[model samples]
Target: MKHCLVVDDSRVIRKVACRILGDLRFETDEAEDGAAALEICRRQMPDLILLDWNLPTMNGIEFLRALRREHEGKSPVVVFCTTENDVAHITEALGAGASEYIMKPFDREIIESKLAEVGML
Candidate 1:
């Protein structure tokens, strides 16, 4: 089974994502902040990451930069799942190496489509 890391400050969101990914047959891991997510990444490289924008310690963009810089050829596919719905935010995330972006209040259909778009589903 593929591994997925769900990085969100909200416990509800993390649980929701974990459940959805689990249903999709992915082994899921949760992180409450970008720093914790990064530490997890260092220990175990997940196949995909569901990232949130506004985090406690390190924001998603900063984490993306660090992950890309450090992992390079081995970086996981990062999909920004956040409330930041502005075009600029989406552009910035994509430019920063995010594989995809999903607005908050997403459902399984949305996640499935995103995974399909990235060829993960």
Candidate 2:
């Protein structure tokens, strides 16, 4: 099964995402912040990352930049799942190497479609 890392500060969001991804047949991991997420990646990079924008430490953009600098970091498809829904935010995320972007309040259908769009489904 493919592995997925869900990085979000909110426990509820993480739980929801984990459940959805699990139903989608993905082996899942959770991280409460970007720093923690990065540590997880260092140990074992996941196939996909569901990242949040505002985190306790390192933040999403910082984590993405740092991850892209790491060996094999480019291999995992980073998908920004956040409340930041602006053209500039989207542009920056895309430029920073995110494969896709998802706004806040997402459901299984949205996640499924995004996964399919990124060829993860």
Candidate 3:
């Protein structure tokens, strides 16, 4: 099974993501924020990542950049899950190396499609 690390500050979002990923046959792990996510990344390299932009510490961009720097393209592919709907935000996240980006209030279909695009589903 593919392993996914979901990094989000909201408990509800994290639970929702975990449930969805589990339902899809993906092993799931949780991180309350970017800082915690970084620690988890160092310990276990997941196959995919569901990242959030507005985190308590470090934020998604920093975490993504850090992953690129440290893991050097071997890091798990990341998808930014966020509320930022601005085009600039999307562009920035993509430039930072996110495999995909999902806006908040999304469901299984959206995530499934994105994952499929990256050949994770």
Candidate 4:
């Protein structure tokens, strides 16, 4: 089974995403912050990462940059699941090596669609 990491400060969000990913046939892991997520990635990279924008210890963008630098181009596909809907934020995230973007308050369909866009679903 494919592995997916769900990084979010909100427990509810993590649980929801994990459930959705599980239904999509992915084995899921949860991290409450970017630092923890990075540590998990360092140990074993997941096939995909559903990341949140706001996090403690390290933010999503910072973690993305660090992950990209540390893993080169072999890093797992990262999809930013954030509330930031501005064009600039989206462009910044995409330019920072994110595979895709998913706006906040997402549901199963939206998550599935994003994953499919990234060829994960």
Candidate 2: the clashing residue pairs are: none
Better candidate by lDDT, 1 or 4: 1
Cα lDDT for residue 111, candidate 2: 99
Per-residue CA lDDT of model 3 for 34-71, tens digit only, reads: 78888998998899999999988689899999888888
How well is each residue in 51-78 modelled by candidate 1, as lDDT tens digits?
Answer: 9999998999999999999988535899
TM-scores for candidates 1 onward, in order: 0.97, 0.97, 0.96, 0.97
lDDT of each: 0.94, 0.94, 0.90, 0.92
Superposing all C-alpha atoms, what RMSD in Å does each candidate have to the true structure? 1.0, 1.0, 0.9, 0.8
Clashes per candidate, residues 3 or more apart or on different chains: 0, 0, 0, 0
> Model 4 clash pairs?
none
In model 2, which regions exceed 4 Å deviation?
none
lDDT of 2 by residue, 41-69 (tens): 99999999999999996899999999998
Among all windows of 10 consecutive residues in model 1, the one with the lowest summed lDDT is: 68-77
